[model samples]
Target chain A: MSLIAVVDYGMGNLRSVDKALEHVARDGQEVRITSSADEILAADRVVFPGQGAARDCMRELESRKLIEPVMQAAKEKPFLGICMGLQVLLAHSEENDGVDCMGLYPGNVRFFGKVLNQDDPAEPLKIPHMGWNNVNQTIDHPLWQGITDGSRFYFVHSYYVDPEERSIIAGETTYGIGFTSAIACDNVFAVQFHPEKSATDGLKLLENFTHWDGK
Target chain B: MSLAKRIIPCLDVDNGRVVKGVQFVDIRDAGDPVEVARRYDEEGADEITFLDITASSDNRDTIVHVVEHVAEEVFIPLTVGGGIRKIEDVRTMLNAGADKVAINTAAVFNPEFVKEATDRVGSQCIVVAIDAKQVSAEGEPLRWEIFTHGGRKPTGLDAVEWARKMVDYGAGEILLTSMDRDGTKIGFDIPLTHAIAEAVSVPVIASGGVGNLEHLAEGIIDGMADAVLAASIFHFGEFTVHEAKQHMAKRGIEVRL
Candidate 1:
């Protein structure tokens, strides 16, 4: 029986994430929403899901004493990050002036403030970029199993991750400009959209994660 | 991919069962909220909204149960409205698996509640539902007035002005429903929706008066709504969510089909 711990550092709605994991869990598989570092480290897999400001997310992770455990889990186990969870793994973020993150991936998170469609520059895209958008898979990864190449997922964030290593980007989506939508390297898989709220394809992705091994 | 307009199916619930009514009167039973929500999720609805029409003290628990049941099966953003009076109420809805909560009466009674809830839970989850009706006088220009209690009473607050104020108070999205147009299915109050959409920086969901796919498209193209919300059109099976999306896609509106 594999245990999947959804790391909750008192930010975002962790319940829906937990519920989605529970829905896909098999007979012996267990999903737990935990903030405890020990529980997170002991789990067979870790799912880090977060939303809110980058500075606040950093503060909560530090205050809850989860920084080391999260870093270790990303390296040791099959780790999945969602939205702000993906952003906090970066080196720095442009949110709230500028905030230093975990530096798990060598990149910076950028704000899409003036992102205008190339076709129509007069009509500027909205901030927060809230809605379902297509994610074009860039590289073959275990998490992309069963999911289509250009499946749409629900995204609700103003910032997008700019990873240094292009080879690690598993998926890319366009929102006025092309941006990295999903990143994968080793055991780590992170997405800018909410798979829990992405419907059929999203559920398939979560189901894939439950069976994914840290290869 | 960024600016795809949304098609949302709204479930107006009374007690634990989903119900449909005309102008908030003569309510007719639809089905179980959980079952309906699941079907919509499978049907590819962009989002699902639940409004507890009979928001009594006792039925609150039932709504919570409905939210939990739907959230378990349906993996989409769920917005719950009705009977939400305080921040604690918003917390209860969110804890019950609602991604966002819509506030109407309480927000008008105490405008600061919007800021307070937004500050605590973040604006992404706080939605301000404005039930508006166009009001005119001899000297004054046409203005939409905010209504409450299922559009039974007016608060005298200008809808366009209130929408801006709510956004300034940290409301992430605005659900603007026209009292005169709701349940009529003539089409959304385009002028009212256009005014609010232009006034607010945040996304505005055009609710009320959607009869067909064309009306839904009109909400996006003409009303300038970021999302088009309809009840009877989707609930009564007049148009499937997929069909509506296909129609929108053909009409040059980007939609996930």
Candidate 2:
């Protein structure tokens, strides 16, 4: 049975995440919540849940000695990061007080900042794109296995990951402005929106992840 | 772009006890509000609304207790109501860590209270609550009337018209509760919820009448509400948040599963 390790860095909705994973894995896979680096390294798959800031998350991961294992797992095994977990998969974040991150993807997390051209009719919207938003599918990914293109997902973040490579972007969502909402490269996959919270399509995504054939 | 429907959990507190049921009927005692709040927060609830059902219109101490407990333990945005009337009440709740304040009877009695609260605390912090009950047909009554004071008093106000007026007065959100369907497990008042959602430009949270995950999906898909709030289904463990979100995800609702 494929063992799924839900990485617990002491800052996530572990119960809900655990429940969703258990619900989706129909093959009787073992799902364990662990703050252990070795357990994560030994697992066949790992899921990273994000709830707070990128800085704290990265620090906690570092403090737990999980950075290398996480990077190794992302490179050699399937890795799923949700929300702020998705944001730190990038190089840096403006929200992190200019902290450098895992650099899993070549992108920087940025806020919409202040609107400079409101009367100019072309001003981009500012941060904290709270509430539900529609995600425009940009590429084919197994995690989005059952979800249709342009399916809606619940989003509550003020910043987004602006990936340097457009080909890696899996989906996009519009706020006051449109940005990459989901991304993937090799064994690494992440979404700015919580698929765990995205409803039926979200569950189906989790189901697909459990059955993913990504190598 | 069409917005996603949010599934929220409502906590009704009476003397620090988190209680659940329809129209406060068949009350099942849940745990402490703080503990319940922590669980919901752990479940990834989009937002949480705590109704101080017992606090009087003049008492501020109870509200403060509820606020302090939640703010100290829970991390999600909180909406606290009950006994809130003045601008200072709004300030106190916000300062106590509530992201928003829900004003029901007060806003209806004085519509300008909504405007003043919005102006003072910013429109984002003001939520106008409408507890609506379907009046009897024929000689019964023509439409849904607003009920206040924990459903103890009926204001005889039209639910739809009042919602529109409140929105116009700058209320940022609407927490519309169906007194009749609450705790009934019959499901949400979809047509009524849809009407209110369509009538206002702001977000509408459909409360009361949620028995199962399907009920929640219906509230979002058919009711056209931005969110759905229920107490019993969540509090009693009939369905955990993950299970509910999974069911919704399978039904194609956008929730954080």
Candidate 3:
């Protein structure tokens, strides 16, 4: 039996993510939401998800003693990150002034800034870029098995990830400027959008994660 | 690709069942809110809004149950509103799998509650619902006035001014509904929606009075709404979400399709 642990450090809505995973979990598969190190370490896979400011997220992870287990899990197993989960995996984030994050991925999370484009200053880019937007698949990976390119994914964040290595970028999206929407390197895969809230394509991604062999 | 304009279907739920009414009266049962939401999800609805119209303490659990059921099957953003009076109510809805909570009466009564709720949950998940009615007093320029308690009580606050204030207080989005155009089905109140959308930097969802696919387009094109939210046009089989998206797309509007 495969057990997937959804890391819970008391941030973001874990219920919806857990329920979405459970809906896609197949035979001999189980999903658990836990902050317990043992549960996370023993699990076959891990899904790190979060919302709110990066500073507060990092603080909560440190307070709950989840920083080590989460870092270790990302290194050891097939890992998936969503939203804040993706941002925190980077070296640092511009949210809450600035916050240091786990250095698993070489990148810096940057704010979208006040203006989308300085040259064409028509619409002042809205912060927390909310709603559905298309994600352009950048590379062919097992995780992109059933989902098509240019499929719309739900995103709600003021900041976006700028990976140091562009090769690891699995998907790119535009919301004023083209930004890294998803990244992949070895067994670690993360997306800026909320697949759990992305409907069909999202469910398919979660289902693929369950069957992925961490290649 | 440009950011796709959203098409949201709103379900007014009571006792776990989806209901629809004109101006909060002449109510009729639509179906189970969860079932309706699931169908909309399958039909490619950009988002879903489940408003608990009952507003009774006893029905709180039922609303939560409905939200849970919808969230379980529908893997899309869900915004739950109606009777959200406090921080606890917002917490309850978000905990039940709702991505956002819309506050109307509570925000009008206690404006500080908007700031406090946004501070606690982040503005991205806090939506301020403004029910506005066009008021033109003799000798004064026409302006939209904010209304509360399902548009029954009017507040002196200007709709555009209140929208700007809500954004300043940390509201991420504004759900603007026009009382005069709500159930009339003629179209959205473009001027009122345009006023609020232009006033606030955040996205504004134009709700109420969607008669056809063209009306939905007008909400986005004419009214400049970030999203168009409808009820009867979708719930009563007048149009599917796909059709509306197609119409919008043909009109050169960016949509998911």
Candidate 4:
């Protein structure tokens, strides 16, 4: 039996994330939502999920002492980051001035403040970019299994990640401009959208993560 | 490809049972909230909204249980509305797995509550639901006023300006519903919706008076709304969420289908 730990550092609702993970977990696979460093490090697979400001997220992670365990999980275990979980993986973010993050990947989060859409050209896109958008897979990975290349996932955020390393970029999606939506590096797979709320394709992605061995 | 317009199915629940009424008159029971939510999820509904019509303090617990049951199976974003007064209410709904909470009358009574709720629980989960009634007609300056308590009491606040105020207070989204055309189902108040959608930088969800599929398209195309929400259209079996998405897709609107 393997235990999947979903890190809960006092951010937005992790209950739905935990419920979704448990819904797709197979026999002998258990999902637990914990902020404990030891429990996270002991888990076979780890999921880091969060939402809210980057600075606030960093503060909570530091106060809860989850920074080291999360970084360690990224390096060793099968780690999945969603929404702000993916943003905090970057080195710094421009949200609310500038906030330094976990530096799990060399990247920066940017705000899409009224950027003009390439498709529409005339009108400026909305700020929080909240809704369902298509994610075009850039590179092949186990997590992308069974999901179509241009499948749409539920996205709700004002900021998008700009990874410094080009090779780590796994998926790209267009909001105003083509922005990095998902990233993958060895054991770590992170996405800017909420797969827990993305309906069918989302459930499929979670099911794949549950069975994924991080190969 | 552009971002797909959302088709949301709003379930009006009264004391834990899913019910849809016309103009708050002749209310009829639809089905169990969980069962109906699950059907919509399977039918490719982008999101589901549970608006507690009862809004009674005692029934608040019932709404929480309803949200818990729906969130357990329906894996899409679930927005719970009605009677969300304070931060504790936000925490209660979020803990029960509701992705967002819609704040109405409280926002009109105490605007700072929106700011505080958004401050404590991020702007993404706080949705300010506005019930608007057009105070003017054609051949004149367009004006709409905010109405509270199911559009029975007028707050004398301008609809467009009120929307901007809520957004400035850190509301992530606006669920704008028109009381004038709510049960009429002729269509959305396009002018009112357009004005609010253009005024705010945040996404506006055009709601109420969605009679047919064409009305849904009008919300996104004409009204410039990011999403369209309706109750009777889906609750009464007039159209399924899948059919609505298909119709919207045929109209060249980007949809997940």
Tell me the tens digit of each residue's lDDT in model 3 across A121-187. Answer: 4455566788888899999999999898888899999899998998999999998789999999888
Q: Is candidate 3 or candidate 4 better by DockQ?
A: 4
What overall lDDT goes with each candidate model? 0.88, 0.76, 0.89, 0.90
Error of 2 at B231 (Å): 0.3
State the interface C-alpha RMSD of candidate 3. 1.0
Q: In candidate 1, residue B154 scores what lDDT? A: 81
Over B108-148, each residue of candidate 4 has an lDDT whose tens digit, in order, gives: 99999999999999999999999999988687798999998
**What is the C-alpha lDDT profile of model 2 across B130-243, one tens digit per residue?**
999887686753478798865778887889999989988878788999988877899998878977887775678899888888998898788877788888888777887778
lDDT of 4 by residue, A70-146 (tens): 99999998999999999999999999899999997887898887355333633457878888999999999999999
Q: Can you write out model 3's per-residue Cα lDDT over B1-257, one digit (the tens) per residue?
A: 76889999888888888777322222243476766777788778999998887757876789998988888888899999988888999999999999999998889989999999988888999999999999987677769999876688888998999999999999999999999899999999998988888788789999878898999999988888999999988777767899999999999999987
lDDT of 1 by residue, B144-233 (tens): 899987788988888889999999999989999999999898999998998888888788999999998999999998888899999998
| Top DockQ model | 4
Model 1 RMSD in angstroms = 3.1
True lDDT of residue B191, candidate 2:
76
Q: TM-score for model 4?
A: 0.96
Task: Order the numbered candidates by DockQ, best leading.
Answer: 4, 3, 1, 2
Q: What is the descending TM-score order?
A: 4, 3, 1, 2
Q: For all the predictions, what are the DockQ values?
A: 0.67, 0.11, 0.81, 0.87
Worst 10 residues of 4 chain A by lDDT: A114-123
Which one is best on TM-score?
A: 4
